[model samples]
Target chain A: MTQQNPQYKKVVEYIMSEIENGSLKEGSRLPSEKELCEMFSLSRQTIRHATGELEKNRVITRVKGSGTYVGDQSRPRRKPRYRSVAVMLTYVNSYIFPPVLQGISNTLNNKGYSVSVSFTNNDIEREKRTLEQILSSDKVDALIAEPSKSALPNPNMNYYRMLEKRGIPVLFINSSYPKLDMPCIRLDDEGIGYEAVKYLISQGHRDIAAVFHCEDLQGIRRYAGFDRALRENGIVLDPEKVIWLDTAGVSDLDPLMDYITKRISTATAVFAYNDEVACQLIRGFNRKGIRVPDDISVIGVDDAEAARTAEPPLTTFPHPKAELGIMAAQKIIEQIENPLMKRDHLFLPEIIVRDSVKNLNKEEK
Target chain B: MTQQNPQYKKVVEYIMSEIENGSLKEGSRLPSEKELCEMFSLSRQTIRHATGELEKNRVITRVKGSGTYVGDQSRPRRKPRYRSVAVMLTYVNSYIFPPVLQGISNTLNNKGYSVSVSFTNNDIEREKRTLEQILSSDKVDALIAEPSKSALPNPNMNYYRMLEKRGIPVLFINSSYPKLDMPCIRLDDEGIGYEAVKYLISQGHRDIAAVFHCEDLQGIRRYAGFDRALRENGIVLDPEKVIWLDTAGVSDLDPLMDYITKRISTATAVFAYNDEVACQLIRGFNRKGIRVPDDISVIGVDDAEAARTAEPPLTTFPHPKAELGIMAAQKIIEQIENPLMKRDHLFLPEIIVRDSVKNLNKEEK
Candidate 1:
């Protein structure tokens, strides 16, 4: 084991002493394996073994594709003044949020800002409570938020206005409440909807059915774009062809699946609000003996893992989940540095074609 | 609309004035809808309309099966000194974390304590950084943590020790580090494993294969229990039939599925670490033209949503997800109130038999 190896112990002790002596500061890049090998006159394997031990001991962090950095415990014992950022999101564990959060955490951590996270579970009441706590905590220096039910008129507007009045820089992500007038970093959700439908049209699919989540502004905007796409194509917007499901409806998809099947029975293609819905629809169709891209073609937004792993692999618009988060962190920090900073970033829609969308033009030709 | 109705407005105005004058406190439960009708001499329909408006306006919250409570903005403008709690978990969004967080947040919010959450993504480095932040923040009164990679030797133990030395109460949820000597509220994972295997054996499955997550103490303990059950049944524990997967293996299961399939080829039943693994195996089997329960039986722990929704619904051991979080919050509060208090809690397992397990005795007869 590396623990028992004399040469590895020497390397570990050298790094430990450097960290203790303030020669190697927290977050600073450590010597590369090649350089370490040269310095210690040891094999590359020994260097790796020592570094691995250091990483496990929390003395260094090895970021993939990035060099190793001096890890935790190097901070000065005396309390240092550092700006803290508060991030509140609808959800933080699964799907897109994980990468988004990873991006935000990484960016902010690199900038030496302490980041604290809170989850609202997409509930307005939880959002209200979280806001109230943030307002009173006196710890947070800035805020990055994904508004709860942004499409709905939020009663928590006063709390946000209060935050503004207090001169706290708050940047919105994914979705922003209209009443807030805050700077936001999000994907071009409407463009995503427009592009997805246009791609379906390119594939010669007309009678396109749509399923939209109606709670957040992103979903609402996407629906708006979907409507515009149909109108531009001189296609009548059939009310029956469009299905609106809220967060609750989305969570328990079993009862909704029957409704969805009935709604899309006459359609040759479907545009789902997200990969989750798209995957679920595909699964539901499988059970009913309907094959994806064979019986009915489907497309979705957000190139989630489900989209890639779904039976037929969905052709979907990619949501810049992590990139958006990184930009949000950078923008929020800039806003913090300069209170006058006012900027909004919108990631353009990019379609990742897989097997879900069928080419009706091939049959026509 | 409720806004235009005079009777609804009257009920709203009454509640608003009561809140403004401090008659109704934050978190204080409101009278039931029936009582409100009696008080206002309004119809039940009108009362419902009024309360719905109140809920939307953030003046009140209506928890299902629970009474409505006075909502945000009821607190005095002057910052009241409230004891704050910090929650650190492995993941906060998907699977079991949502309900667990809900329980913790609800309990803490009800007690007028401020709660801040952080995610570690089950990484020791993130845990170290988060703990360092918590230590430096000096805001947290107590901490409720789910230790990251609890089965492995953790390097962040010193930070936890520092928190203890600072007289800040820390209670662990899900899993606790063995070296910490900290109080934890978690499911009896070992018993769950033993019970799941016993249930499978009761259904007459002799050749059993097991897949275990080896990163956390819960998984390790569960493995121990599984081994005991096999030994008790006089069945030789086949190393080839046992697969020990880490967090990375759990995340990207495609490559591992082949190995798993080959390992469990001779086994009549398989016990997965959790519902996720079980559902993945079922899906993997489906692709290989293998049917669940009909071809091979499967059992898993954590009655996650996927368990219920999996093709053939899974037979799983129930995890006290939210209840554990609630108990953790409650215990941490108790510890905060009395620093000398030290208690540990373990939730016993119960199996939810769905369609996944098949009784071989029926075929034998």
Candidate 2:
């Protein structure tokens, strides 16, 4: 029995040798189980056992109607030597994510690593589940997450801490848990806010409303920046001019629009947190027969493609989005390649001036 | 030596068995390797060997600062079983791909299989490389592809035949190769074209200009549909009205816009092949001070999200997007679970009305 088991191992090794030597090209049918039985002079069960091992290793594909063929076998045979990296985000369907993914994919692919993407749909439970899955799978080498607004006080934070304790690197983008030691790739929310307001102020607008979706850290920083910019320019912050829209637990835009309409009369120029809000507001204004720039000047953050193409064209803060992607990928790669490296990396945002904002004085001239 | 190996295996096996049996939960740290070696009365090398196997299988994660802990073992212990489904497309970052991916993700997630994504980037060499990768990897049990617009003399068609001969299931989505016997998720391009024109005509349109981007199967179908709709309504198809914008070897919208402008007159209504083209037209029209619907009503196909958010909002055909994802996923899952299943599936498209098109009577009133 001892000799028999070793003999089966030898047979399996022989087949692998043939495959490795290029004698068995992909899609080339393998010898039948009966033929293998005859050639190896072994019991059918033993040959089956040997073939089963080959199948488990993904060295061959077994089709019932057809015969087994040599598998691609091109995927690196060397097991991943580094810790796994996990990227958690809300959605993968927009322009924002593809470039991020492209940057990550290109970097990771070059480093001979594989990346797995998981979507949270902004659900706390799903986010928790996804993190748990990543930690448990041990498949992820590192983590690049855009956390749900409810991350703090959420149990998932504990789990994230656990990963940290285990020496797994976790990075946040467009979101942050500042208390956590993990590094983040965040937009200059404060800068964007300041820039939008400064531009409006420079255009000789005394009354400006900054509209923002509030829920997380980014929102807080942006609101702070807006306040700072207004104060720096000696414009007293009007509580009414600061409109905070509740995006928490709200996914639709109708109620938000209603709120904006009630507040629109007081401000001559409006600044929005992101392009989506800017576009929505523009649509709402158009519905009211209020022409953009001519009736009310507007500016928005995030130089998303929508901003540039919206009716009057949106004037937006040109965020270095691709750079953000590159930075995150680079950070993760650096951490992976040099586990001892420790430094917090921050990237700057660029302002892209488009047509959405109405320069009231310029238009009059 | 055999006894020592088995003894070391037993120690590691005991810990793993606790994990598998739920006695040890994920994130729970384990005993030191030295402790384990001592407990098994085996050398450190044997203990290391066994623990290494456990780690490779993703059953545990070892951290530098922290000790080893139980890893996510929720994924099936076996390597993912091979399936017949493959997705071949140009650039994974395009606007149309996400909804399709969401559909595929939801459908396939419901089933027990994983889908492999491959990108061709519109290059024939990359497309061929992707195919070679897919075929050799033995990862895809079947295929769903939107072949490159320029992949002619049908090199891909023959590859599909090769997969078919090997009894692998194949399906096509968004685009089709009619000569191939594969299931396809296709839009009723003819109906969409006819409907777009018919809607414009119903709004009291007379002089109409149609713009097409390319001469691929999709472009051909849309053009034919436009012509058929015009002919059915007893409007003479003016060769001049059908302007084929040279999109070949071009990726930008500026040249196309210039071409349209030079040929444009007082055409009351304009129909475009897709929302992207419609958006470019809106921008071009804005530059020329030509009012939409007030001067020329515009209709587009593929009611992507951007369509609804475009300046005036675009009226378009809702491609069978979600269904395409579901069908592709279902087809792949079926092929994976039951390798004997045959291919050939088709879907339908629906119209979504929005604000981009203006009613001439409404304007008159």
Candidate 3:
């Protein structure tokens, strides 16, 4: 490359210089073979070789039935070259994840970086595959990923390390593996859980039933909050009253329906994992002639659209969906540009009170 | 013009041949400068020159802490090159669109292409900006877009043509513009509408009401079905009973509640545009002391998660959300590989009978 082929290199540089100087723009038609031969004072074969080298280098393309034209390879002068980063999440295209994605995309797009998103469906294997694919990808300058089954040890740590080796920074969103000292934008799920149960206890409801998903770090942390609140309140955490759901998605709600119908007298209130479960619990209770608050008070977390719009307006804690996305994107962009800049962000959940939770001191269930 | 420099050209060709012959692979660590110099029996300066030229050509990258390695551009023999495409929707992180996004991602990923997602939020200005960004992007080889404000004439047709001019294929999903003539995978929304009304009529409900959105092609097309069925049943469509909503997101439902309360005596059955609206109508009816099927029968489209979980599960036509996505991806990939290939796909909506719709002939309001 130091001692270049003089003639073809001259032709390539001439066209490239023209492109660089704004005489040739993207999709602009290049000079025909005869015209190039006249301009460079070279044979048609020489022009053909020059254009062939250009095509090989992806500097131009020969469209079928159309003339040769400039390709997008040559950087546009007026536009900042838009670099792209990716975000890999557990449940994309779900009820809860979209707003977060919206925030991330808005932030990244505004900063001139296109965002690529991948969903792992909360499967460890898919997560491993996705991380590997992303690690090997040259187009991605950085990444924001939510580790799958975060409470358990992951097999994909090597991929993350590989990104580190390649000097491509990765920021975690929501949960992260305990061993990986990664930057993350996370919700204080444990604190939210503690607040939820503490609020119920403060309302004079001593017996609380908790429905939690135990597989991920978020669920485990939230349960820890539940345990802490119950301990501080001088109440025994009932093993029989706890419902553990599968981590991937909605588990069989039949177990919960049965518990709601048969074991209602055991607990005066219920703390659901999120608004979706709370809504389902309400529907289940209504089937057995048990009304919310009037029969069993219920509260949940993640004040999603369903929480606000659902009948009785579920009382829960709001996760910073958009804020999380924005934070994660900003961190990744900051890291991509500076490479040395790194930061961790945490968003604490705020209690959203609605009609679901009843004041036990004022009324009897 | 056709002549090549003997020394650097030989080294470049040697390494390329080694790569092509499976001696070097992607992400494989190349020999160090000292070893390469000794192996080639060349001076350190010559080896440095060759390696620098390789780095300039992106044949290899030199990590600071780590040794030099072959980059993705040199081509791995075992792995196929991963291509990237984009999916642009109005609201990507919404209820209805997530499943479609999922479908697109799953389909494209399976075919070895990475997917980048963008949202325009149904704003024309954002759509124009996003399209311009995508058009100028070299990474996105194809696009699947749901045009914003599709009912009105678009100002972004020239942008779509720009994608065409750059040889990027486009496939529309769910709804499309009338004049675009681009390949699209659409739902038979009008057919679903006709079926919903016909089913209600078959159940001896003639006083049927319809609520639709007028902003996009789907809304208008579905309304056509509603009109056709009402006319076929010999019932005049009531202008007052027909409710139209904005397409961007959920509009305020206060007007709809007013219509439901005031016009309850006029119509016994109402068909909604989708499950979200249908769920809201059911809630409205409940607030007014009206019961499902017993007082009013409601039908909707898109049997989303809300439809299944609503107090009385909503009866509606199922939107082929994932299918449309997969079809669009497949079509885009097909056209990308073979630009001349052009075809349209239509997914017919099927009725999913749930508890929301009542048989009016057997039961009286």
Candidate 4:
């Protein structure tokens, strides 16, 4: 009756009540194992056992890698969900994205779900068009997406509402702009950026410059982290040292190149919002006859492929891209099972020290 | 009536006859626009209009982005397919791969097919497990995979057969070995290597060294190109100048370091199998106090992400990553619709001259 109940038993009781009360209706999906793990404060193994028992008792039906679902025999006969989901993304051929998508596909596929992939390329119009096309088909039972132009308000909230109106479960990844009263799973972009700056400051970097994208949620949030870190450290930010980027032109770091050259003597360290920019910054530095960790230190978020192979390797923050995708998939599946649930997830970034940062503290001593 | 019909009308007749005659049958997909394009020798727009009319008449129902299919109006109505596909790769987060996958997803997605992504990590066991898991689900209607251990015979060919047995279409990307009677989309690995060596020769580099991955198909093929080029130029391959790489430890260029340190003085140029190896080779040369194109000219194949950002911005061959992926997706979709097609695609690599390969002829002049 209280918290004294063993978690697994409580789980069984809670699901039963949901079904009996019609909160969890027949022939609908159940919350993902991950969600149940958190809800019951139990490990996945325990949740699995509880779900397994339910399946055996014919109280629920279990699909591998997919979540448990309410059984027709448990209540009244009803049609099972269409084994289909829509996954919308932006910038498919670049860093962080492919892995995230892979995570989504693997998780969905295991559970016998078919995955439809759509790319908006971060264009709002394209996002709207793609969403409309997918939603109108009504083939997909649920949808998972990365909202385009995530830092700005979305113009396609109506399509999202249509998804809701049609009883399709919806979930977001990366940035969930125009919240649409829906749940999202994203990285702690601001936190990672803040930590990166803090780490640089800890290594005795005072005059640090940064390259960031200005148009997206990740860029804006990371810059906010950078700003917050400097403010807390009593270091005033210099507008001259900030390089604002358009996410679409990420490969063209010419602006970053100019900034690195002009500020070579003054800025002791450079921070990039993502690993690709960091690698570019290093290349730009090399072009100007500046050396990484010697003439200046470099730090970047997202310990992506570019960071690993960049010259001197890069000191970076781990973005946990695949995990975010998995979480997003699970959230959408859970929503499909229960339309009333509202939960958001944010994964934190971790630091990985490579050869990019210069230890000014040791030299000062 | 035999063959004088307008191609679009012919296409319509072809499809309906197949359905009515029980050849194409029920529950099977119709050909893609591209396939229909080839078959009818008509433009895509014409084919689109023909399919559009069919969709409107409800003789065939079109799932957006997925192919059109015949429907049985006399029987109880049922929804169309899952519109799902499985895309398996060796890696997801690295150079050239992300873009390739993006192309596949984008192409398939436009046709309304869902994608299930799987990673093999190039381990045969992992490949088998991933394939089995995908096959067991039977959720995917078609599959596009990059064969792992592509230079060696696949142990998981049986799983591919199972996919065919289940009426699911299969296609390969990058390389196809064990010739599972399925088609593949790949790059001309040998041609690129041959061209790289020839370009280096044109620069008057008589003393050349090469780094290769001897295990994979690309590796062996590229090495063959290297050897053929040397022999054609009346230069015998010195074993000391050949640094064979283990594809698994590609990032750890320690073996390459040893090669550069010991061979840099005698070797005037180095050819790397891919851009990753080229970038690493440059770094190794730098560690040995040798500058790229100053002490040794460098050329590489598969001008990947590493080549673009490397210190010298490597002179390499362009491996059409995205096109290959796109081709594989289209091929699989075609297979699903036809089931009698057996066409393999191999894309040619082109030269991209950057700063890494030094022109010794200029110096001589």
Candidate 5:
């Protein structure tokens, strides 16, 4: 079953060279179909055929959801993999992850590092399993992870310690475990929160409501910042105006928002944890006969794609999504090289003024 | 390290009983932290302690991302596992998948079957890998997959055939490979397409444009139906007015919609593939100063959550999301019990009238 076709043979040779040169490590995933097609200028069929041949030859293995990996699945490779990095994220295709993943993959791929990604769905149990797999696999030299439910007490701390003990450097992205002495690359959530609320306050809105995800460290930090801004302005924080949520609560905000509507009816403005929540709140508000920036003002963090197309566009703060991912990849590689190295970064937020916030002072004047 | 606490002992005993009763099998994942907490009526700390003890004793193994399994990872369990099922999907948390997953899990769990899920991200390479892993695992008694790019010339057909040879019953949901002889539960995409276009025509629309995903079979079939409706109504098809897209193209519709504006300028109505696409097109058209249902009526398939929330609300055909999921689960279980059983269903489409489509006939009169 040997192929005489030059294109097929070329692909096979390219893959073999990639493995031989340590560009594709044993147990590491190969580049995606789109990437392979772009690299070789080959059709999908030729690429699939080449991979099929490679799989039969025991040089590559394909797993359904995780993608294709180097080495054979029939035998587990005990040797430490070369130039391989594993990324554990909440999601790979949704929200702000695409850019972040692209940033991480593009940076690592250019440096000849093989990257394999796993999604935790922001579930602690799933995160624990992912960490255990990476620890036992011996396929990863380093890891970059976004802590799942960072505000909650996570039991996966032991797994992180085990990775550290094994000399496999790990870096946190987006969020980190407060107990773990690990470096993290993330946006300044607290600063973003402060800036969003302060901007809203500058518009002469005294009564403000906030929707926050209590499970995420980012959400908690942002809420803290919101509190600080209100305190500094000599405004008393109304307990009823603040809504604490988790992952599940964010999806169905209608019932909660309806109940919150009456409680926060006196509030003139609402600060959401992120653009997604902000947009949903606006919709939930609209459904209840309340209009944004007219009946009430709204502001949010993370100038995500949703912010631009939102009903009145959203007044938001930049999240530094891709930049954070690139930095995390660079820093993780740095840590892998120098085990003693420690670096943490917090990208400050920049205001992206949109139409969601209303200036009550303008009307008063 | 002995746990003297009765709560911890009781939790441990319950897990042991589950395994003993065959509800939990070797190489199958254990219930999540929330599930355990609910079942035992115990604190998370106690549940963690019991699981820790279980892990230490080799009663279970925890892997990050994938979750905790009921067997040791040090050795591969080659024997066929009991009452375990694996679901392969494009996504678990986004768009229409959550309801589908909930339906499947709820139904399966009620029958004492443990379910594990994997996401393909609609990438063929990832799907291929997922199939290979399931084939090698020997843990899953049955498999349910939402085919990745069902319209594409898939090379993973051999993997499906291999699953069949191994006596593993496979079921498809949402979409299925046309080449594969498998039971699938999905919506009547073609009928929905025809119905949508026909509805627009009934509202006195003659020059209708279409937007569809070329990679998905649903899109292709819908386009076919769209074509049929046009021909039957003595309306000639305009190739320039039809826009075909893939996954990546759907994200940023601005540039494409900008170009398409000129070509589809004469089009009085637009039939979108789904509500997501329909909502984006409405926004795109709105940006281009074209008001939906006023300047041009629009109809979409899938009365998804987006349809109702869309600016003017969307006129769409319904997609039996959760119902399809529930039916797929029941059929898959039937197939697993009787490998020779064959069942395929196509849920009929029903139009949900909304504000997006205008009555052009009234204007003409």
Candidate 6:
């Protein structure tokens, strides 16, 4: 018991005793890496590797920006215990939050881990500040964040980097900053765009207009998909029919309405970035006495719950939003428990058709 | 210097020295009430009174179940500095999380304190467990929670009582359990229900159906309001038209759908419990080939984002979900900074009209 794996045994025994004595406690952060390295008189890398093994054993978790912590292994060893995890998003009062949260909640809850949530309001400053606070506070054991648009400068990359350096686990959902070392859970936005446009094309709509909120990496990918579909279908991308709104600068609908009205001449069918933006477009079009599908067909991404109840319904691409949340939570947990585990997850999006798009053949000639 | 008010002067000097010497960090949990009493060799009640004065002076915050912590005061006085404060929630991915969060963030940020959040996924066990974790972690200075309905069945009431006994401040949102001695930030659910029904009557609807999701104090109030509206209008409540879905037990939509489809009749209008339930009902009706507003008018409570984008566009009661978050955060902060300050807040709900509810006059006879 003391010879071959003495160092390993010592670290394991220390954590186990803490758990048994209820000293480390569940959802509590362990000592810093520097402190552990010093206490063990071992190299920082060696200390981390040992901690990594413990993490893989599900005895502890490393929250990014936050330190490692004892995992939720309350019972005597049997199966790997699911450790506590947290998710941070910009807004939760949308159709997307419940399902996505449900996905994460159900998955973590089943694994015997609790999930905590935070909202950033899509403000980069707020997002960075909240992340820093979470990290410094050492409250959560792991984090899954839907990062603000990559195009929008987030001044908090250093904090995220610090978490990575500490071997804490973090996963990005919906969008991720490419250069970051963190894993991400996202849909094939370009593929979704291509599928959506192809669906509309199959319905015999030649002239399609696409509307998107700009300055977001996700929005750009979606636009790329829309462009690719049009290109593959032998339709040139018409600059006039594409409406791009600077959502980061102005979060109002007036400019968006004016942009859509101007494109009414050449666009008989429209593809929107997301359900919220699509709904706004519909409301604007309706105000001008325009009818959906009959006058102009509209499509959106994110088969949000609102899409189903929107006037005439919204035909759009459905992504595994909640599934993404679940996967992200699972992945971050994996990273926390198994520091050597390195994998990327890509979720696929589905196209859901309803009344928002019209069949050209049904229209009166 | 230690003349007339020797005890008060000594306490003030001790706190100031700790602050200036950087021994008391911002967000750090203060010494326990019993420990402070012992250190000062004073009665526990005297220590409590002194702490109360400090709290009023914005020197510290008492988070129930957590501990007393340095307040978010940026004063250059001869004292230690605290960095920020945070408020936690159970979930943020709903129609209600945003505005309330916005209000909290705005208020807290303006006051130079940072706000952090956490969610418990509505599990009472998790809620209780997380509270303990958050308390020991010493993360935020204060907390504002909309406790789960199941909290009543557990020892959480006693736990919170102990917290209050120790001088920590907590504020409940949306749901109030009188057994807990805490302030609550809620909405006039009954008034909202009555107003929603009154609006439908004004629109010339008679045979209106009311669909409610069961359990919870808020739901009860909303139902009472709905019944009051019908009673005032001399419209008898039809048991057949009142569809109640046990949302507490069943988290999925299948049961809700089954309940809605089985009870839907020749009612001209339907009043749903909330936006989430209303959207589901509309989707169920659409699946059955029934056109909303044309076949049956529908109204929902909670002007959730989904309601605005539902297929026919839901008409709903506009409850300030975000405003509730903000008010709850503010009240909790106030309580934390001033233990003697006691107050309760309740917000009002409004009506937002869209396409889901149709005017009877617009129907073709």
Instruction: Kindly list the interface RMSD, in angstroms, of each predicted candidate in the order they appear.
Output: 27.8, 28.4, 25.8, 28.0, 25.1, 27.2
Candidate 5: regions farther than 4 A off? A1-81, B1-365
If both were scored by DockQ, which would come out higher, candidate 2 or candidate 3? 3
| Candidate DockQ scores, in order | 0.01, 0.01, 0.03, 0.01, 0.01, 0.01
Chain A (candidate 5) TM-score to true chain A: 0.77
Once fitted onto the true fold, the runs of candidate 1 whose alpha carbons sit more than 4 angstroms away are A1-365, B1-82
lDDT of 5 by residue, B290-354 (tens): 99889988898778788899878998888777887788788777677545345578987779999
Task: Tell me the lDDT of candidate 3.
Answer: 0.74
Model 2: per-residue Cα lDDT over B1-365, one tens digit each? 01122555576658766865789897888889889878877888988887787776566777889788887434433232463356777652266888887898777766655667778765444666777777677666677777664212234567767777765667677666655645566677667787788888888886788776442456656766776677678775544455543233123455346445655565888898788788778878888888776777788887767788887888888776777788778766654444323345444465677776777766677
**Model 1, B46-104: lDDT tens per residue?**
98888888776456778779888987444332222347999998882259898999999
Candidate 4 Cα misplacement greater than 4 A, ranges: A1-80, A263-265, B1-365
Residue lDDT tens for model 4, B1-365:
01133557667767766865688866678888899999878999989888876665456777767667776334443232578888888882278788898998999899998888878777666777888888777788778887775643344678888888877878887777644767778777777777888888998898998776643677767766776787789786664466554443355565336534574459889888777878888888777778888888888877787788887889887878888778777777766765544466677766888899888889988
CAPRI category for model 5 = incorrect
- Candidate 1 C-alpha lDDT tens digits along A27-56: 899988999999999999999999888776
Q: Output DockQ, candidate 4.
A: 0.01
Indicate the residue-level lDDT of A50 in model 1.
92
lDDT of 6 by residue, A236-349 (tens): 666446655444312445433653476555678888888877887788788888888788888987888889899989988786877777777677666676543345666666
For candidate 6, the clash count comes to: 26
Ranking by TM-score: 4, 1, 5, 6, 3, 2
Worst 10 residues of 1 chain B by lDDT: B72-81
Tell me each candidate's TM-score: 0.41, 0.39, 0.40, 0.41, 0.41, 0.40
Weakest ten-residue segment in model 5 chain B by summed lDDT: B1-10
Local accuracy by lDDT, each model: 0.79, 0.67, 0.74, 0.74, 0.79, 0.69
Compose the digit string of candidate 2's lDDT tens values, residues A225-323: 786787778776554455544342123344345445655577888887677778778888888787787778888776778787888898887656667
Better of 2 and 5 by lDDT: 5
Q: Which ten-residue region of model 1 chain A has the weakest summed lDDT?
A: A73-82
Alpha-carbon deviation at A364 in model 2, angstroms: 6.8
Q: Candidate 1 A-chain TM?
A: 0.77
Per-residue alpha-carbon lDDT of model 5 for A1-365, expressed as tens digits? 11133677677878877876799998999999778888999999989988988886567889999899988877543333588999999872267888888899989998889999999888666787899899888888889998986754465889998998997888998889887888888888888878878898999998999877755778868876887787789776665566655465565566456555765789899998888888888888888889888999889877878889988899988778788778878877767754534567898877988899999999998
Complex DockQ, candidate 5: 0.01
